[model samples]
Target: MNVPADDITGAPAELSVAEVRTAFQAWLHAKASELGEFRNLSTDVDEIFKSLSRLQRLLYSEGWIRLGWPEEVGGLGGPLVLRAVISEELAAAGYPPPFSFGTQEVLGPAVARFATPELAAEVLPRLLRGDETWCQGFSEPGAGSDLAALRLRAVDDGDTWRLSGEKIWTSWAQYADRCVILARTGSLESAHKGITAMLLDMDTPGIEVRPLRSMNGDDEFCSLYFEDVVVPKSRTLGEAGEGWAVAMFVLSCERGAAAWQRQAWMRWRLGSLAADASDLPPHTAGEALELIHILRLMSRRTVRSLSAGEQVGAVSSFDKLMMSTAEKFLFDTVLSAIPETLLLTDNESARDWRSDYFYSRASSIYGGAAEIQRNIIAERVLGMPKD
Candidate 1:
């Protein structure tokens, strides 16, 4: 796990997605032996994260992971789709993405867009290099999917804000180096209008992280407590009382670009499921393929639109809804096909299947519940009435 520090000097300033993909494939082939250690990572979540960080370091050293970001933030300067291409290629090669991949797509863009230039330049490189990890601080007690209902309060304190509240269902908060949190800056009645987004170092005083173990037997989620945590005004993501825009933008990336990454990983998992199940039913496999392909198309459109600086708006709700549907169906089909692997066996592959099966049950809940997505599509996208 000893990765040498690398100066980002030789990376290309520009490259098409196709060019990036081709070169990346070639690199993977040439580095197959060196990358073999990542093929079978340890079951311990901490170990898995450590090994994945090494893989990320390798990719960053070679400039694959940094390809579409701004050079000012440690990138090679290409269309954002270039990074997507690299991620998909990694999955195709049976490699797991760096743990920071999701955060990079979800919170990284918001930081780059809404944060001050100095902040973006200072923090984004650490994210790109996997030198740091971040977690989103959106969901809270009684505000899981209804983000506007969150009650985390940010009180004015002259040059800083004092934060006090609890945030639930924060993914990997215990290991995070930073967090993008939303707090109420106005009256409770103001709801979304009074919200404001801010960036905070996870190690700040008066902050506590309590890990929550999921059914998958992993401490993947956490509950964060901020008791009079002081944050500088310079850390505000956007203007005070304008955090709704930041929240919306972050959620858009979560549902849009993050969906793209998830679908890629799911597609790879589908292939793994097929190879492991010797007697896998043809119809089930076909059905799974169709579901994954549909998600692929939807996610691809969203990724392209986002790369082009286009606002996908409520339509991304379809991608979010379909992603969960496809994921649940895919994993459910896995459990149904190989009940023994998931429920009876104790080997590594079996453990993987077992973990994924249990985790899939939550697909309908995280990143905005499936019901929330449906409601968004119905009321916002289709002009349906909420009665």
Candidate 2:
């Protein structure tokens, strides 16, 4: 699709980060007339998610979302850093990313890296174009952080695998069109070594999704049940016993690549916080900005490593820890600095602040817990003896 004449002057695949940002800002300004209805998306999760999906289609049509992906997967093909810039610019321009942005960063790269070429070619574009949504099924009722302990059994039936088990805390699974699921293929003694990963169509029989409403009153997470959900061998992400490696890869992206987007959005949120509570003491916003900058530095390194073809590995745990810290600190300041607005006001702005502040409490628990990250750092990064 052709970019609006006023916003693009060159091929998307060749544009530098700075060039893309400048051009994209112009496009956003020009498209303001079209995007007016999508503003203030965060106030309502359902409306925001729907609007963001439409926003994804808008970005894909302009070729902005295609820059960092491979041409074979229906992308323009450029440095991974380009993808970071696109998300940053969107958040900077006052648009919350489509939910797909988070899933795309967390799962898209892993699929591109491990899925068969035909499978990647067929599904990746659907995700990119916002024609469908997907969820990760790594966490089970019994397995939250200890992903290897998951018991979602995927028994091999010669030509196809039958998945039977439950997954919990899968965000937005109820609306997903597909899922990236991890299941056991070997005996319990094998742990992670005996597991396998597959890309399963969510519409398959015996698959069910029931969204879990969080304290924020939004059904943003779900519990997924699979009862002999049949998946073809061609849908396997990698070799049957190599799911541990795939899980590792997906986790790294979730913490690192996604953090870049998170930081950019956090920076915007800080700006909003500052503006809304300008009457507060200087130290409040000062500390908040400082913490966010530290996170930006950590996440920037992760992004650069990813662009340079380097695996972030355990380092992303550190990023996640810092990310949660920044998020919690930022919102804590919001509640403290503007108590009346957050606790007393009745407008949409106040409602948004209240909701976000509550959600920030989970920053430490989601995307692997802060406690887990500490363990990883102490053992894996610091080479300390595990207790």
- Give the alpha-carbon lDDT of every model: 0.88, 0.87
**TM-score for all models, in order of appearance:** 0.96, 0.95
lDDT tens digits, residues 185-255, model 2? 99878998999999999899998889998987778889998899999999999999899999989988988
Candidate 1, residues 14-60, lDDT tens digits: the string is 44456566777777887899999998989988998899888888788
lDDT of 2 at 316: 92
lDDT of 2: 0.87
Clashes of each: 0, 0
TM match of model 2 to true structure: 0.95
Model 2 residue runs over 4 Å out of place are 1-10, 42-46
